[model samples]
Target: MRANVDFEDLHFERRPYDPQVAYAQAKTANSLFSVEATRRWQDHGIVTNTVNPGGVATGLQRNFTTAQKESLDAAEAAGVFTYKSIEQGAATTLVAAVAPEFAHTGGHYLDDGREAYPVPDDASLADHPHGVKRWALERAGALRLWEVSTALLTA
Candidate 1:
């Protein structure tokens, strides 16, 4: 599924819910938030980053739709990804939170304990399993997301 920031229907209130699409959009929004937060708060010494804690079998999966479960199973069978243990999943997040190399930097997508390489926005997840999509960190989209989110909150 393509990760998109649909400015008009961000909340999906007017859209049909496809689990993959909604998840992708939500993840993109999260990445965009980190990008915009870093840009706006760097001067104040705030740091923010996105972390991909790759597929731990947590309670979060309890909500997975049948299609989502089948998709994950298929991807695993195809060697695209493997589920990590909870501890392993948290390792990447810990790297982002406390690693010395990440202390002063922000807005990077970290996976498997390091900054993930950037892939084109159109890159297939099967081809770049550990990569971050370019659009997820687009500065202009981040800025616009920040503005739109602010307006929503204040409205």
Candidate 2:
């Protein structure tokens, strides 16, 4: 969502979209999107939560460059990243989709089938926090992104 803001404010020519950055930010926005959804629909028994279905060995890697694949493979070898099977990756999603536990923590971010803490701005953390960033939870930004996306869809 904020990607649109960056693209709009900076213009595509001035700030060409970085896929990785946009993707991370988009995931952040997704958490906020859930937050906004929870706020708006909680009264109707809708529980909206974010799930970090940990890395899966999906065809997503097809887009990676050979060098990127090498780096990822290295990370996997070093126990830094583990690409789960599709079934493993889908576990959390299935939980969030049907788990009664999520009904109470509607706005929480889940990882490994548990709610995770909000990660700070620091990018060098070794633990690789599996939670939403504070920026993604900002109510104003959520509402703004929702409005902008809605406008685009309507237009």
Model 2 residue runs over 4 Å out of place are 1-18, 123-125
Candidate 2, residue 12: how far the Cα is off, in Å: 6.3
Error of 1 at 55 (Å): 1.0
Q: List the residue pairs that clash in candidate 1.
A: none
For candidate 1, what is the lDDT? 0.87
Scored by Cα lDDT, where does model 2 land? Answer: 0.70
CA lDDT of 116 in candidate 2? 71
lDDT of each: 0.87, 0.70
List, residue by residue over 105-145, the lDDT tens digit for candidate 2: 58777887777776665543247546555666778877887
RMSD of each: 1.4, 3.2
CA lDDT, candidate 2, residue 62: 72
Residue-wise C-alpha lDDT for candidate 1, range 2-103, written one tens digit per residue: 777889887788988666677778888989999999988988999899998888887766777887899889988988879999899999999898999878
How high a TM-score does candidate 1 get? Answer: 0.92
